[model samples]
Target chain A: MKLYDRVRVINDGYEGYGIKKGDEGHILNAEIRYGTFCFYREDPETLADDASASVRIEDLELVEDGGATDEDILEELPRHNPEWGCKVIDGFIYNLKGERLNEYAYDYHHRRIK
Target chain B: MKNLEALYGKVTDYLKYGDGWVRRENISPKDIDVCNGEATDDSDTRTCALCVALNRTVFKNDNKPDYTHPYCKCEQIPTAPPEPTLDFPMRKITDYLFVKKRGLMYSMGYSEEDAKEVYQMIATNAKEQFKQGKYFLNALDNHGQKVNILLAFPGKREKEGHVYWIKTGWTVYPNGKLHQNTPFGGWAK
Candidate 1:
């Protein structure tokens, strides 16, 4: 229902997208691109560890209260490396050092930029 | 070629189903040099990055690919998966991104008319940086390995001698193909 909410797949419609009933994931984005919610789903059994996908809102059931928020992510970002500072400018997220921090390129861990 | 044959068999076994198996759809002879599997130079092995990723995924349950003995030495089996060749799907750029992020592209030294050129530049640079292991690992979602890289281009302030560093996102698939996820993630330092 909200970003960072832990949810479980409750619909079989997402089978083709590699999701199935009872699969758990963390919501990443909500209802922007044509009402589809994007979430990061991981299945250790099949080695789908880094999997993410988007589906209709009706397919998910919220399982937890909170996961990560904007402030939470930003607070965690600097701990990955002391030199990094995060900020958002004009709808795009970046580090104080000027590194882009959006999309799959998001180095909240500061692993790639340094 | 015995080592290659053995490696191939191992991959096939791991991906095998009762009556079906993973398809080696995009693999080509040119992508891997089997005849020179015994080459002294690592180019032949390096070229097998895709195959290495494939097998690496096969061994994911154990967290590492275990290629053994004669095949290990004779085949130059790398202890780790080599940097895979990147797959930049052009339509993702020309059609979707160019239309969606026209402003961001322009800010990064790319114009509406420079879509193809810009895409080519990103693809080329991404491949080079990836080979150098400059990419950062992001979360794995969508059944793919999410990674990011910082790429530099002639900046919007080019006349002032500034280089624009952009963060690009990609999904590295199990088959060793990488598809660009975000053409732009904002300007990098």
Candidate 2:
């Protein structure tokens, strides 16, 4: 997904985040962390991107606005982090095992809890 | 006086200094949230004062290396609009938390795919660990060697009701240079 590309949520989105199934949100930015997409609630009042989410490319059907194609979208998607690409779910970092790591405690990234 | 004592309950929270020693903090849960993400602002679940001030002075501010509660895995903002909890049905660990960077994975002797597999193993089986100055992990490494792991859980949040969410984890080894790059190996050991 590219910035400002109109997209629709295929599956029910995260309710806690106020995302619902079939909710049409604008792709505020892609290349979020890993291969995830960041979008915003389609509202003028909303300034920042409403949500940063990882959607299966299949789960999001592209909204045609004279924007990029399937290949373009896929190419823009990063396989992994070019930088220290940690997943920040609701602003906390976790390892792949669903356990929590205290990386963001301080120092932009906190020193590891010894 | 007795009521005040009950209100400001003496809770000795663990504090870390630069020298790598833990200092005992005698604090009382303040009437307000006091920065630690207690679920209710009410008295029952509140954390104490010294802990709150230390949280801001050390963890929230620029004070070189940071200090943290020994048990708080996730650093949820201790303020209004508590961070959202895991929406999905709570499980042992979140399967979605992946390795941070591709090059880091390569450096750690793992292909992107292999690193993902390793992460999957860590999150699926970590229990609530509360050991100070130690890795609270018990898992097998890729080669089946038993290892200690650290996972970040959702810190104090209202959605989580002042409890922790076992959201993510990472694996570590003692002699990390002997094996993969364990992020917490140097300090955690």
Candidate 3:
């Protein structure tokens, strides 16, 4: 599954992560890691959500494709919190309202910073 | 504290220089959630301490790595020392199995009274098995240092007679400490 693709958990082995079979979530990203296809979860929002697990591609089944765009989600953030804003003073750095983020934390396309 | 000293070496070595080792909060890019197909603050869960004057400091040698928060990004600078082989302590093992995941243990046919025996059975074998590289990689947090190793030990549940009870989550720190994040995920198919 690719990023933004909605998918269902086809595996019940993730009970420790509070994820069970039939639960659905959005695919934040996907890539080959440690020689296996894995995806990240972004839905089933909850306050207690703090950890992200490396889900194998086979464990998930696509529910929908190309559901939401970044701008669609960005437009919703300021409505929820007014302090939220992006200031790129330097090389693709996204700083928070109160934090001084100078070093590049991510790429322009959200590719993880190595 | 002694365990940390044993793992990291003497604190006075760094203290003599006066620029002692401080555990800086190491935030991995994986901890930051991506939104809108790009990195955004909308889903970031990290809470920055507003005061900004440096919250706390631990000696480089002391090596008091924070274990309280699962998502804690505390890191020791100038290259974290290597952890000795088999750093999974019994206290951490039992904490994950008994307290953090007690309910799941019950669901897997273990009782409150069986906590000690259950851990004794699992922990002893887990350490030995881990030494022999008998675990599977279930998942990994971003940056890849923090990983989830899947481990299974035999247990007899009430409904499911003999089973390979899977303990699917563990994390590796920059200092090379192995921590159990989740003990009971379910049984292997």
Candidate 4:
């Protein structure tokens, strides 16, 4: 089986729907993590169009030493807003609006890890 | 929902026999010829039969789920199937299959029109394989008859590559056949 050399992080604007840069809506101190169980074909078009595409969460680790204390966390608040919406599923960070984020989330949250 | 089922059935028939079956539904022959283009004698009957069986077995629900209309036929469905507890990694296999086939198609420099046609062909074939129960090896299922298949491919993202994942639901047959009712959009990527 072929494994991706490096996981691609498709950070587009989907998750941060109503939330803004400094808004509390951005999940910053919540130890947010995300990943996906992707079903992709070699071709870009197919990969893009796969309706069944999904992601899964393996683990959610605390953003330990996120470069600061509470004061530091607050200082870095703007940066914490996941320049894009970063969700944690099965211990991986993934963008929400990408091709497989929802599927991955469903699989992981629903415990369909394989 | 019944209308949606009828539409789904019609689309499946169209995939199985090209546009001819649709033409038989009182559609004009000229429209059929235009939509289907030139008919190739290389059609595989095995794929058609498998599609018919898979749709019947997997999507035969009488009651519609509380999600979007099943017959919408939009690129993205408003709702997804309920997540199952089974650990069948069928999504991985389906992904691998998609990547393998699409990668080959892309490498061959197929035009958009050709790619779309080929994509539909692959989906139909996969549905047939699933129906025949002869394609995949490892799978998991719940009591509801929902099955998942795990698949892998070997290759790099830029070059040849293989990866693993799972796929769920009855729309896809257990044998790894493509659904005859739907056109494959993967090739358009």
**Candidate that scores best on lDDT:** 1
Every model's TM-score: 0.40, 0.26, 0.32, 0.24
Candidate 4 C-alpha lDDT tens digits along A52-78: 222222311222222222332222222
Q: Which regions of candidate 3 are displaced past 4 Å?
A: A1-114, B1-104, B138-150, B156-161, B174-176
Stretches of model 2 off by over 4 angstroms after superposition: A32-35, A44-52, A64-114, B1-189
lDDT of candidates 1 onward, in order: 0.49, 0.32, 0.41, 0.27
lDDT of 2 by residue, B39-126 (tens): 1222343543323332221111111113234443223222221111111111111111122123323333445444434444433323
- Count steric clashes of candidate 1: 9
Greater-DockQ candidate between 2 and 4: 4
Best by TM-score: 1
Q: Please give, for residues A1-114, the per-residue lDDT of candidate 3 as tens digits.
A: 343455677887777765677877544322223212223343343211123555555566777664333343233332233233332223332323333233343233333333
lDDT of 1 by residue, A1-114 (tens): 444466788887777656778888655432222234566665443212244567655566768755344444343331233233233234333543456544433222333333
lDDT of 1 by residue, B1-189 (tens): 977876686666555432222223222233222311111223544334334333322112212223333423222122333345654555446644555445556655566677787778888888777655577766543223456778987755343366777777765543344555566644565
- Candidate 2 chain B worst ten-residue window by lDDT: B86-95
Which residue segments of model 1 deviate by more than 4 Å?
Answer: A1-53, A57-114, B1-83, B156-160, B174-176
Native-referenced Cα lDDT, model 1: 0.49
Candidate order by DockQ, highest to lowest?
4, 3, 2, 1
- Model 2, position B180: C-alpha lDDT score: 17
Model 4: lDDT of residue A84: 31
Candidate 2, TM-score vs. the true structure?
Answer: 0.26
